[model samples]
Target: MSRPKPNETSSGFESPRTDEPLFQPSSEVWYKDGNTILIAGDEGFRVYAGMLSEQSSVFADMLEIPLPAPQATHEGCPLVWISDSAVEMRYLLKSMLDPRYILKINQTLDLPALCSILRLSTKYNVVHIRRRAIEALQHYFPTTLSAYYNARERRRLSSGGVSTYFLLANTCREANANVLLPSILYSCSAQQLDTILDGVPDSHQGRVELSHKNKSAVIQSRHQLAHLARTGTLRWLYSGEGCSDKRCVAIRRRVGARLLEGRSIDGFVNPLSTFNDALVELIDGDCCEACQNAVERCVDNGREEVWKKVPSVFGLGSWDVLVKAYGQE
Candidate 1:
């Protein structure tokens, strides 16, 4: 690793400055039999024209336009300047060159690699490459709450907690994945307020920042989630009051009150499980059979209602919209 070179000033103060090289050499592994060189930032990659042309029409069209005279050359090949990061270029080029260089899917991928493939592939007009990258990300950001939990749980079991949802959400917006916004917004609402503002860093993309629109959505969604938890619970408890067992009903109401006391659905790791457990414990000797059945039915109905309204609660459109948007993939 190169250390920062110290520069002495007239004020007798020494400051570190990075002396970046003018040009970076192409990697031997990537400099295989080639006809063109793609220079990204300071790095150079010598790759075949035919391969790039086959995968990307943009590259093909560019290759067809004959250059006047090459200002720069890498090992006798004409250099094509690209403003993209060298890391992204390498990833994009490697996938096009090597058949067995499998991009990760159905699992947690390095955020930068995932982002690079999605962004660059879309830019280069590589339809299949872009589609695969989009699909891999969609696995994490589903359209519905049930699908979200299922994917989240599967990921948790397989690889523990991955804090890439924020980045995934941002990437989806850039990729024009509006259908996934509701679930992604809900996930954001469940995060710490500080995380929503400061954002998080990943190995590949460095600090993945949230946009202003997403931040505003998060703030609004947080209030909506809390409101739903409070009012929805109360609504279910009072929906049916003509009960034979008054004491049992009173006890159930007390439990519901305690569970819903200034508490937001965001706080519950598994709201459905928590609600079910809280009510199930009351089915013992203390509560009568009639009250138990009533509580069971009430919880079931409340959960169904909540599931149906969860999208609207978070300022999202209906489930039909989410389903339709998901199908656009």
Candidate 2:
């Protein structure tokens, strides 16, 4: 492949940037017989024009434009300059050209790789790749509460916690994956206020901070969620008439007092999740069966209510709006 020197603008094409250093051919995606070279950032990828055109309508239209005689060529093929992140472009091109580059395993993927493919795929109009990337994200951050709980129980969800949520929120916004934002932002609200504001440390990207708008939303939602958890999800412990058993009534008062004091035994932001089996056992062991059943019903109802309000709490309108904006799949 012919290596383009620094600051050389190809004829009949506007270079994406003029100050970029010499373009380095990608060792992974460069093919000896490739018919076209794609320049992203300071990296060059030699790939078959036909393959790209076949998978992406954007590429198809761009490749169809005829160049003047003696057009700029890298090696013996056409040079196409693209304004995209080199790392992301490499991930997108590798996924398209290499059969062995698996995008997912058990519906889970590395966050950076998944985000890269999603961004470039959406930009380049690669429908299948974009769909797969969205599906992988949905596996971890589902729209419905039941799916969220199921993934949580299986431990198959992303383990990056608040950091991961911050990344997902930004990526989904850029990729126009609006449906995934509610769950992602809700997860972000579960973290400490300081952590959210200070940003999460990322090895490759440095400290990843939420946008100013997102930071404000997450902070407001955090306080609102904590309040709701006590007043709503665990309301049975405070306002409900316990069974005639004096002991059951006492247990309710004790737990409710502790919760009001911001002393959650489980330390979970989601009130519904905090009332796990262990907490249930603590209450049920002393209370009558009827009281036990009533507590469960209250928690379930509260969880549903909170789930319904999540999108609005984060300023994303409603689930109906989000689903319509980004079709559920």
- Per-prediction TM-score, please? 0.72, 0.80
Once superposed on the true structure, which residue ranges of model 1 sit more than 4 Å away at CA? 1-31, 41-43, 61-70, 106-112, 157-163, 201-207, 231-235, 241-246, 261-277, 280-285, 288-316, 322-329
The best candidate by TM-score is 2
lDDT of 1 by residue, 191-248 (tens): 6766777877656657666777777777776765555554554354665543657777
Tens-digit lDDT string for candidate 2 (140-241): 778898887776643234455456668777878778788888888887777666788799887767888887877888887876777777667887877654
**Global fold similarity of model 2 (TM-score):** 0.80
What is each predicted model's overall lDDT from 0 to 1? 0.64, 0.75
Candidate 2 achieves a global lDDT of 0.75
| Alpha carbon deviation, residue 308, candidate 2 (Å) | 2.0
* Clashes by residue pair, model 2: none
Task: Find the candidate with the highest lDDT and give its number.
Answer: 2
lDDT of 2 at 234: 85
| Residue 325 displacement (Å), model 1 | 5.0
